[model samples]
Target: MSERASVPKEAEETESEPEQEPVTTGAQSVIRALENAGTDYVFGVQGGAIMPVYDALYDSDINHVTMAHEQGASHAADAYGVVTGDPGVCFATSGPGATNLVTGIADANMDSDPVIALTGQVPTEFVGNDAFQETDTVGITQPITKESYFAADSDTVGDDVSEAFALADAGRQGPTLVDLPKDVTQGETEVEPGRPETPETYEVPEEADDEDVQEAVEALAEADRPVILSGGGVIKANASSALREFAKEYEIPVITTMPGIGSFPEDHELSLEWAGMHGTGYANMAISNTDCMLAIGTRFDDRLTGGVDSFAPDAEVIHVDIDPAEISKNVYADYPLIGDARNVLRQLFDAMPRAPDADEWRDQCQTWKDEYPMDYDTPDDEPLKPQYVVEQFSEMTPDDTIVCTGVGQHQMWASQFWEYTEPRTWVSSHGLGTMGYGVPAAIGAKLAAPDQEVVCFDGDGSFLMTVQGLSVAVREQLDITYVVLNNEAVGMVRQWQDGFYEGRRMASEYPWIPQFDKLAEAFGARGFTLESYDNVEETIQEARDYDGPSVIDAHIDPGENVFPMVPSGGDNGLFALNEDQLDMI
Candidate 1:
């Protein structure tokens, strides 16, 4: 669990008492339902339509962090959910406030992160009259949420929220929303909601079928070059320990998807890091060469598999997932074991008779790692390398420090260079590739794990999109380090324009971008700048030493590009190390 939700001692002691229920408004009932669920914190912005709920919150115990924007609130809640297994909660008013949460909701849906969004609606009578600050929020969000609710009655509003909360953290966890109308919230209600529970139709598979497990074990027993592929699902299911034990017992090498970066310690002898576009070359090589692949908790998205037909061409795949619909949806699963990751891995471990003899295969993998090392040159005269900065931070922080990033070259560099030793320590936007996620995510991670150090790596363009988040960090007195790899442009887009679009950079460059360090200072947070390697160590140390929020605007080489590239729809086995190699291919 991220942060364990706990009821008050007074409530726990009075659990068996049957006192008379007090008369309460629907808004008060809503707050009562959250109290029942033991919600620790909620991130949201106040608005006119949601005043009733806010008024009720005035006396409630839940810690509500007021964000600068609805989008930031949603992102913060999303990150909170990512860190903890429980669903993070957020609120927004009708119309624009509700609509602003769309990106974060869509992001959570795509990444399968658990979050609950409560959106206020116009009064029921005025809902369809094109009333001010009203929109068909349910209609707009239905496709993005695991489930959505339109609360029409004051008597059942609390129950509606309870059900929505249950569904958000239930099977294949994702975002769920509750649309509360003003009239319903303002109405009177005496009944309180019961404990949260999913509807009867919902069922979670605990373990795979016996026949499927037997078949998978037989395949593994007969394999020569076997590999274990771990995805974000492993982290979500809290099955990293089971996965590690299974891999080690079977003497199989492990590769991770980007979102699965922290599932296995990157420094482990058997670890090949992650595989996909811009993934480590050794990991991609292992994925291509394996004869039998045991993949767990992954949907095998296109970015990870590249060309579906070519991905793991020589491997007979045994895919394990809780959601049956995802089985064989992308890469064909030779053996489909449908169940929870931890349970299924436990079954596989018990059923397997002996480990495979892949000594030669393991040696070959080590050779590949040596052949394509993740190294870069740093001449003293050249501008600061982003990779060096990432490595420096990685070396400076503890192994368990939480890292967040925005989508761009900086994100890739952070993921590639950092050595992750624990699960839930790597937080970022994946699947949806949402930019401007670093700042708010860092704030949420700090709240989720108050003792752990939190750091965010962002690019200039991405940082500019959500710089307003700095004010919230300062206000909260959160200890977080924000590192911006300012390349004077949208680095990733510019890199792509240079490589794939005949070098015609259109609106990707931002030469007039403001200095982020000064901007952080203006927001009442500590700030520092890095022009070269001369001050890299001292600058980073000063930022880390600060007791409150800080930003390091480290200007980097504009010409630097992310390599180990697999052009869209290309085979993962044939990734290039540079643009020149890409052109030659």
Candidate 2:
């Protein structure tokens, strides 16, 4: 037979045999990697460049939630991580989708939350060519993310995603990003159907040098008025129990930062609640007057320090944290211990003797707490007070209900009024102070603990920022109670304008006020408008009993401001209290 014709039909069939189904594509690898990493949920929105990954997601076991906006998805992911103590996963398409996530990513970064952000990029050929929907995600997220990765080839998809998760959940947890090109996602490759090699484990040192422990112990022993200043790190490290035990062992008063509100039980006898700007007068007073201050996991940011030169001027400071860079970056530490909060606290507790008698100091702090106890009174005829509403809500909600807040006056009020008995129950954008974070974060919190009630305390301005999230909540049928404290203004900015800008309202006031109840109804959620405080409790109960999402628009005092406020950069002693309440303190 002629050589060309002699090719066996069987040989031709063998050569043309359909190629084995690809073991994996870049997209499939990404999804499988996440599944291997134990990711239960992913919050994101689909788009052109990311369609391939979304297609892969459709077949995966992971639960995917499509949010109204990328920012909402990011915040939702942020809360998921905060509540679960795992890296929350978020995906976004290129360009505007990626850019919209910046604020939420920055929020995670500032607060040290472990969030994994995955963004789609244009094909490799178009990466630098300014193609449609193309942007340098790695470059854009560099400053905000703990680490950033770009998967230039299909082979790196799994490795890059695995590394991003590892980095996000590792020491000093923060957001991490992985950028995947469209072509890569569409490319086929043979990938093992198993988890990647486990990343190196980070263990907090169990023991501190004897001398360092002695130094800290001696500092505590010598000081009559000792205080423990806790921060978000306590919660992040899952060391709230350790912190409480340490405080009890030392009989030291514990004051937390705003982000650390629930780190220590507010109802604890030793608890000084929160300190720094908008902190209780007593907590700030204790920080300013302590003879020895042991700050753990706190960066002592300008907010906490107020006037750095004047902060804890009289106190000998012992700062402990995992990151050495934060040890003395802002406030100088007399003794710096670099280690994990839980591990270090455990060691310190074991090393130290029982705290010396400091009854007089303790009593003095108690007196301050009594004198300036958080209080707000509302006249029967006066418009409903936001503080009262929060107090009632706090009282009525389940003890473990997760409370999330949008930024501004409502945030400070929630921090002050709500009694957070558990860690991770209080969620908010502390560092970035991003508005419109509450609703979506609450959604994430609800998803994290489906049985737990998730309530969002949002302001009029803040609720408007992400009101569209209501549609998602309704679609998912999440039983979330959103309380809008409607003052019809950017209350916090207006407060500042009133206090510092000679009452120039400027752009702080909202020209048009949308009926939040109507808006909620339009979004297919139950709605209630409370113009009076007479039935506040009843309304809350009704909303709580409702089987799905509900919005309660409670008209609050427009002029009310957060009290015991220390002017920015001003000493704690410069607290501005209501005129009528000043004498009580």
Candidate 3:
């Protein structure tokens, strides 16, 4: 009997027993939280402190785009936020990696873009000891973030992350952060994370007070000349269509802030384009002279208001915003309507007694547009004008193409020349004005909307700041056209120096620059050089037609400057169209 019955009882027990669940770590719970929130993509730079989280990401279905630098990852996430109207997620390790994300976080805060940043911290025990790669991420980012948290325990780390994710997209929508200690993330945990949800204390205003809406409507109705100043918040709230309908029904002219470029169709009859320093002359004039201004989601930053005393001097301002804090922070709001843009607009439409008599005002706005047209000259003898390149590309691409830009003269040119007809099509660092945003932003925009074509306009110095982003695009095989307006200098700084610093071009101009096209080729992308008109169309077409990333080194006039400028503290109506006209201020 002993020889015949050799089978172990353990084997039979194992076969009959149910399979046990795999052990879940704190890091796995964090990933599960994001998955529970339906996150499809994450942009990040890997480091030792965050290794556990990266390991967790391995088995998850979320697509993680590894970037060459933490700064690029942050910008990419910011752009993703702009395009999707969701909280774009970014990851970084402690110390330098976390510090690198500061600029992007600040940018998102200023622009009111939704972004979630997950930063790794040194083990909880080593936090104050200055351990390797240690950083006080929560402390550093608190001012810039809508809310920042330190994950104190492994059991609640996932909820901390989930809360951050929800908070980033709630209320006025800004950046949020969660600092995960290494030990906390490595600790064992089996608690499953629930769906992302903001705390009960968090509440967004759905509509404006009825009395305030009525007052705003009355002011607009009584206005002889009313202009609607649409800001980035309109697009962020997905209120573009509502804004358009309201403006059309009332026959009021629409003026966009730089970040509001795509909130209203640029070519529409009531469109005044954008208004600010270096904005369209007509838009600025309209903002300056309006008798009543209905400012939607605009904070009336110094750039937009110029000399506050002179901006809309005769106008009674009706400010509509989701965040009440912004109602009268910069500009006095005669009528404050605090609510979501779309909801408020709908309320205004329903409450209006009748449409205002704005036909005459509309005619006046049209007159301004005809008088101050956005046109640039391109003499065959001179080097190519970047504006021409922008215009040509705009004409060649579909209207839905997404345009991204770095901060500089090229950015102003792209904003000035490209006609945006839809929301979420123009992605740029509006509030922070980050120099190296273009290449990385294009990558993000393309990823966010894979079906839409993407174009990045960057200047030589600006492009040089984060050109490594091109490597990410190349590696990912993203379809994007990067047009570098190589002027061999920090064009904006040079222009400012030339105009205000007695022409002493101190650190602004660069004598030598790498041919960006060749650099693109080195990065395994299609490259083209546009030194003359002979290859302008051919080069751009070929670059746009390329299936993967492409860079065009389009040599532009070194002396070119962004005009229609309102000198700091100058009147918006008195924008300088050229360097010679600057004296008027």
Taking the tens digit of each residue's C-alpha lDDT, what string does model 3 give over 1-585? 011111332453345434324438889888988876667789999998888999999988899999989988888998998888877899999999999999889988999988999998899989899899887898999999999999988889899888999899877999999998899899998887766789999999989999989988988898889999999989877899899999888888999999999899998988989999989999998988899999998888998889888889999999999999998898999999999999999999999888788788889989998999988788988988888889889999998889999999999999999999988999998878899999888888889888889999999999999999989999999999999999999999999998898899999999899988889999999999998878788889999889999999999889888988999888999988898998656
Please tell me which predicted candidate would have the highest lDDT against the true structure.
Answer: 1
* Residue pairs in clash, model 1: 2-84, 2-85
Clashes of each: 2, 0, 0
lDDT of 1 at 288: 91
TM-score comparison, 2 vs 3, better candidate:
3
Order of the predicted models by TM-score, top scorer first? 1, 3, 2
Instruction: Give each prediction's root-mean-square deviation over alpha carbons.
Output: 2.3, 9.9, 9.2
Worst 10 residues of 1 by lDDT: 1-10
**Per-residue lDDT of 506-570 in model 1, one digit per residue for the tens?**
99997598978889999999989998998899999999999999999999988989979898888
Off by over 4 Å in 1: 1-23
Instruction: Look at candidate 1 and tell me the lDDT of residue 356.
Output: 90
Query: Which regions in candidate 3 have their CA more than 4 angstroms from the true location?
Result: 1-23
The local distance difference test score of each candidate is 0.90, 0.86, 0.89
List of clashing residue pairs for candidate 2: none
Error of 3 at 292 (Å): 0.7
Among the numbered candidates, top TM-score falls to 1
